[model samples]
Target: MDEKKAAILGEIPRLRRYARSLLRDRDSADDLVQDCLERALVRLDNWQTGESPRRWLFTIMHHLFIDQMRKVNRRGEAAMLPLEASEAQAAPAEQVESIASREIIDALQAMSPDRRAALVMVAIEGFSYAEAATILGVPAGTLMSRIARGRDELRGLLDDAARRRAIRIVEK
Candidate 1:
């Protein structure tokens, strides 16, 4: 049992990185990792020997991430993100990049959780559609459509933001 747990521990960093990219915040990623570890530990008896431990841990993490996404979608951004003011005050960066990242995050938050998950898995994580579909528990065609929609929506938001910036410059 100790050996099994030790082996599972080795995959935590990759899981954390994947969760961080999916969640886009440090604390949330940590929480996801903790949850994934707990779940994996509790379910260790079910894990078959010689199967990919990394993939198994990732599957658990991905499911937890999906659940977190659904909860946020239900509650909306304002309800989920109470640290925004503090974060904004502390952020030191070129104004344009900050504004763009904010717009992108906002656009991502507006997307359906399923679509957002698909985007993260396919685009950000560089997972193949088949692998993403397996993680998402959806058909590959469905995953592709969700990715397409997510990309289109993100592009629209970015384009609108650019246009607004251009308009402001013109007015000045």
Candidate 2:
């Protein structure tokens, strides 16, 4: 039990980071991480030794994140904050170009939850296609389609967002 607890403790940061990226809100991410850890701890007796704890934790986080996304979607309200404000308190960037590129985060928030999760798994979390497919519980071909469509949707959404921003600036 102690060994299992130690193992879970070690993976908390990575799990939290993935959740934060998916949820896009600091408070909700932390809550999700805590819930995941508690669930894992309770189920630790069933966890097989020699298996990757990180992967197990990630699987739990993935399900929890998906469940939360569903609930949020049912509420018919957006969970994402404005992209610029979200980045303002992040780690300082040494280059102005880095700051300019931060608008992509906002664009990501505008995406559908399925696309956002798929894109984050591949593009942000650096998971391979197979790993992401398994994590997302989709067939490889379906995963590919989701990712391709996700990219196209993100591009369109971001372009629209940027255009709106530009128009607002011009109007001002």
Candidate 3:
């Protein structure tokens, strides 16, 4: 593969992780990543030659994710079962960690896509605020606001989840 193609290929793991975090469904996330790679390769020339393609590829993915969300909204698609109903049996030793991870992901899923993307890019992906803003096509200030609001939203959601869990334990 050419250098540019190689660079794009190298980012697949990051893209997949980001996509999974955004969509919260492995199959859908894989499709989104595939769509993103297809678009990126087809428009490869549009990428600036010397600059790193990291931000460029992520921008493409963010745009595509938005488009998918819009299409889903218009269709009023059916909802899938949440993680709890579909969760597999894990080893007892891993249950607590698994539940905690699922709670965090579920909270992320509950956020609006814009705020979730903002949080994921900056906090999870370690993008700078400015870089995430540029990738998300928002102003820096807007990105910061989204991150703040997202953090608060996550806290509230997680707290609610914890309370529910505690109540269940106490009721037992």
Top model by TM-score, which number?
A: 3
Instruction: Please give, for residues 20-98, the per-residue lDDT of candidate 3 as tens digits.
Output: 8998667789999999999998998889877668899899999999998888767865244343432442324533456
* Ranking 2 against 3 by TM-score, winner: 3
Distance from true location, Cα of 131 in model 3, Å:
0.8
Cα RMSD (Å) between model 3 and the true structure? 3.5
Decide which is better by lDDT, 1 or 3: 3
My TM-score estimates for the predictions, one after another, are: 0.71, 0.78, 0.88
Tens digits of per-residue lDDT for model 1, 1-172 = 8888888888888777677556655677789999999999999998889867876777788788777766766788545554333244443344334666765765665566678778977676677898878877888899999999889987886787678779989999
Query: In candidate 2, what are the lDDT values of residues 11-115, reduced to their tens digit?
Result: 888887788667655677899999899888888877888877877787787888888878776785554444455344463345243423555656676677778
By the TM-score metric, which is better: model 1 or model 2?
2
The lDDT per prediction is 0.74, 0.76, 0.85
Clashing pairs in 3: none
- Model 1, C-alpha of 113: deviation from truth (Å): 1.9
Q: Looking at candidate 2, what is the lDDT of residue 156?
A: 82
